[model samples]
Target: MKSHSLDLKSELLAANAMLRTVIDENPNIILMKDWDGKFLIGNRALADLYGTTPENLVGKDDGAFNPNTEQVDFFLKNVRSIMSQTETQVVLEESTNTTTGEVSYYQSIKKPITTADGKKQILVIANDVTELKRVQKRLEESERRLNYVLDATREGIWDWDIPTGIVTHNHRWCVIAGLDDNYLSHPLETFVGLLHPDDSADVKERLQSCLAGTAPYRSEHRICLENGSVFWVLDRGDVVERNDEGVPLRMVGSFVEVNDRKKTEQALAMQSQLLNAIFELSPDGFVSFDEARRVSYVSPAFKRMTGIDFSQVNGLDEVAFTDILVDLCLPTGKFRGFDALRKKRVTDKSGGREFIEVVHGGKRILEVGLRSSEASMVSQILYFRDVTHESEVDQMKSEFLSTAAHELRTPMASIYGFAEVLLTQELDAESSKEFLSIIFKQSGLMASILNELLDLARIEARRGKDFVFEVAHVQALIEETVHGFKQPSWREAPKLVLPVESLYIKADQKKVQQAFLNVLSNAYKYSTATSQVTIELITTPFAAGVGRRIGIRFIDQGIGMTPAQLERVFERFYRADTSGNIPGTGLGMSIVKEIIELHDGEIELSSNAGVGTTVTLWLPLIG
Candidate 1:
């Protein structure tokens, strides 16, 4: 009996030792509280949490260990509820600070148990979950930030579960699609239905390609809204979540409205096409330069005018290109350097326009204008127009005014001097009559000059509008003009020789007769008394093409002009006879030239000083 009692005590000692080991080795805090919330049993883990030994914690309430009133109250309340059988078990979370000021979180479980003394005790179990809760809070904050960013951008966000065909989209997605909010959680088909019919197949194809791992999910397509309006969206996405087999299980993307940008691009394309057409078809020349001053465009007219093919010089720098232009068009001693001109134009605050004289195949005048606007490539545009004919007309006007002024002075001097001589003289009837007759003749001469000047002016003022044109025989016109020239006492009547019976021509008959009459008058005016003037009409073919011309030749043995005088005879107010003996205005030959040019014919005059003079007028023949 003594040996059995000793063995029982050893077994009890071993059981207590095993229980202590189990309690100390467990990671959870295990403890028991009486129904009144006082500690009755405490394990090593529980004592460690309270910063005390298990024996010190016995019979103590939560007030001894936890300074937080709310925590202590919560602990007592959970224990009391379990002890009263109001709850089978209580599970809760609590946070506390340790002695080292480190925060700790705990998940606690409490259950009621009946002791051998018939009193109820609450068993408590706690596990530390501070790190897990910290991580969870961080994930929540990150998700909130992501949502804020998506909302701030005002972009539609979408997530698709490929396997389930379920689509999840934010509120903004519904707004962009012009649909109700219920569409946010709809199937993928609902979203797909909003796509424009023309773009639906392409969108699906791109999506399928991405799913098949052939391409990334990115596309631009149009979507139709409920209001029957279409909007352009730039959709970009990638397979953010994938299965182990590289299959796309989910897709995330954003829908950005690209309608404005698309419209702008299309408008720019159309403008470019229109500008290209203008460049090809415009009659004037156009050359554009980028900010870098390289040749950006060259028009067809520019190519034709310069004979410098644009294809060969398209990329040439401005300096080199300007040099080529200067070499080709700038005449010696006339125009300034291109660089200086260009710099002046650029610096001028006023509208940058420049006029220049260029010697192309002949002489040419060009007007260059520079234009820049914000909408341009921030580039400079150069426009060129040829004004050579205008320039020549201006020069002719200047010369005509100077000559007319000089010619009027000579006639005025004669009239003024003769009239003064008659007014200041005291004489008999014969002398008075002689002086009056002289004055009357000079007055007649002045009247003739003024009438001729007026005639020429009127003809010029109304170019061909007042002229009556008709078809007439050239031979008859020449005969009538020659017959009207009266024989001078010094010269014989001119003989008319006709090579053809009838040479027909389209002409202003009255003007043609006036022109031929002027030619015959000049022949008689310059020839001597014994000289015989010959007028002959002949017809010839044009050398340039299949055309015919009738020629009228006036041959005279007269006081012909020298080479220098002959050159100036056709100039207004320039006479071949500077000796003041010839009774004629220099305007006759100039008028003859003008009339012939108006008829689209040419007048040629060849003369020798002592020999005879030959003047031939050529006119286009009628059919």
Candidate 2:
């Protein structure tokens, strides 16, 4: 009996020791309070909350260390009530650790218990749930935001249970499909039925691919409605749940109407193609650069104008591209190379550029313009336009102004000098008469030049609109003009060679007579009195585009002109003979040429220095 007692005592002590260890090491708050609210058995967790050790907390109430007197009172009341109860009761309590300054939420189980000493007590066990409560709040907020987004978008939503083959659709889906809310069918069958025949197979393939995890479930397709009308939709979803073996169990997605967006994209694509065609065919060239200042695009015209192919310059950087352009272009004012232009752009702090003239090769002139791109990716735009013809026109205008002024000044100077001499000095009648005659002749020459200029301007501006139309016999017209000509008494009349064939022309009679008189007068004015001028009527040979033409040839035995002079013989105010002795306005041939051309006739002249001059006026003959 003694050994048995000793063994039982050892077993009991070990059991008590294990229980003490289990209670002390527990993470949850565990304690026992007597009816007087004094802590009887306190674990390490409960003692730590009171800022005391389990050994030191043996007969102590929370009033010693806990800062809340109200909390202590409330707990004492609960302990008294629990002490009276026969069955266990539960309560939740909150506590704060003064040492750690940590607030904690706890789910506490309060139970009434009887100690070995026959004292009534309350036992409390609590687990901290602060992190779990915080997590629950966060989840609720996230759910609220997601639901708000869904409501705002108003997109058609669908959920599919892969394993059950069950599908659920929102009311928006039915509205989008033009179907009643009560409509029901197999989900896959309804989906396949709504797809256009052309897109059905591809959509199914892509869906299967998505299921196989090869690609994403994203597709744009046309959906046929109840009335045979079709609209485009962007259908997209992803696997929301997967089994442990990686099989898709659920998918969630939405449908959005993209009909208008698709149509706009198609129209923009067609417009882009048209612009590309224009760039390819245009004479102007363009170059585009990327954000890195590398060449991004070169139009076909750019390659043709610069003789550089995209294959040669593709992917070239700015400096390298500038080198290529420098090789192809001759420098203009303040522009040494493309790099210099880039610097200038930076200096000016502007994108707009003036047209810079650069000579490409020997004859071609190119005007270049540049605009810096404001887009984030594309950097700048460069354009080249061929302005060679416009440049030539500008140069010709300058020359015309200079030459016309020079010619007019000569006649004015002569008239001014002679008139000033007559005004300033008293002279004999013979000398005064000579100066007056000089002045009179110069004034008349100037008047004739001014009149001819006005007539030429009027004819060109009207383009034959002011002329009277008539038909005249070519031979009769020539004879009448020569009869009216004031033949210089010092020069003999031109010899006439008449044709027997009767030839007629459609022309303005006065204009035709005026042309003949000018040519005949030039013949008399430019030749020596002994020089024989002959007018010969000959038929022009048959030639394409020149129907049966009658040629009136005027052959003059006068001082002829060189090839250089012949080249500019038709120029206004240009004279083959620049000597002061030649008494002519320098406008006779120009006037004659203009009138003949206005009548749809042509003139041909041939001459050699000191030999003779031959001129033929050809007009279309009316049979």
lDDT of 2 by residue, 1-623 (tens): 23543444444443344335434544456676777878767777777777889878777787876787777788788778877987644445656686986776665556565542246766666655565432121100000000000112235888888887766788888778778877432466787789989899998998888787888799989899989888778888878888888899988788776665554444334334323433543456777667787777787867766677877777788778767776665556222546556676677654323454444445466656565654554566676666566667578668867876777787799889988898999999999999888888878878877788787777766768888988888889988988998887877777889988778899989988888888887777667789899999888676787777888888887888899988887887788887778777677788788888987888999998888788899888777
Q: How far in Å is the alpha carbon of 242 misplaced in model 2? A: 42
- Tell me the whole-model lDDT of each prediction, alpha carbons only: 0.68, 0.69
Q: Model 2: which ten-residue window has the lowest total lDDT?
A: 139-148
Model 1 lDDT tens row, 85-165: 835443545645435545566655555555322477665556565644422211000000000001112368999988899
Against the hidden reference, what TM-scores do the models get? 0.51, 0.52
Candidate 2: clashing pairs of residues: none
Top lDDT: which candidate number?
2
Once all C-alphas are superposed, what RMSD does model 2 give against the true structure? 36.3
Return the top candidate by TM-score: 2
